[model samples]
Target: MASGKKRGKKPEVEFRNTQLADALQTQDMAAVAFALRHGPTVVPLMRPGARDDPRDTGEVWTFRDPKTGQVALLLFSDALHKPEAMPKAVGLHSPEWLRAFLEVHGDEITTVFFDIAGPHPMQASPADLIAALDA
Candidate 1:
């Protein structure tokens, strides 16, 4: 689940900060539960009290969001550099953050799921994620 796999027949869209927000929130369950709903699967990466280093928070995480029917993958972490420190350490990309981010920057994201990886970006649909998981 770590890898961003292609799902469904429509396409997988690259959800930006904005769109992700709605998926996380706009529901009845608590923030945590909501995020879990969108997330296809939980990939435990870090753990609690594993090391001594301050940077190492013993936190764990699964791969990227699978965009399952319950909920889309809403990412949250602490290591906030300037904009977004990619390919770096991982943390709790909580559902609350996902909703907030999407509410603020939903327009910036590009949709590409309907098509190939390049050319245009699409807002990955629920069905698309399911298909990708099956694939």
Candidate 2:
């Protein structure tokens, strides 16, 4: 006999970063480095169209400089801190995702920005971030 049953919705993962957020506020490089290596990061995403599916993880949002054609990867300690100018979508990614992203996009990304828009913005070279991830 065959039975028809529907699976319940999966619980959502809450995205928050206390350590990184605090580190950003104090401009603590060491704490920020530790947080980046251990904590989840908020990344803006770009979708091809209106979100039709709830499971969609859109592409990461990036900025390319018009003059130098250099790319910058923007990272946030919290999703709520994302600026209005960026894509409306945001994702909370693990430290593994950060490492992978930097490994894959290191060549293209010249600078990495933390809390880029305001409230203690910090910048680091992709090479430096990669080293931190490795450590």
Cα TM-score per model: 0.25, 0.81
**What would the per-residue lDDT of candidate 1 be over residues 1-135, giving only the tens digit for each residue?**
557875659663323333223333442224323333344221123454345665543443322334742332323311221123233444433444334433444344322121112122223533333333333
* lDDT tens per residue, model 2, 94-133: 7888888899999999999988875768889988888887
By how many angstroms RMSD does model 1 differ from the true structure? 17.2
Task: Supply the TM-score for candidate 1.
Answer: 0.25
lDDT for each candidate structure: 0.33, 0.84
Clashes within 3 Å, all models in order: 32, 0
Candidate 2's TM-score: 0.81
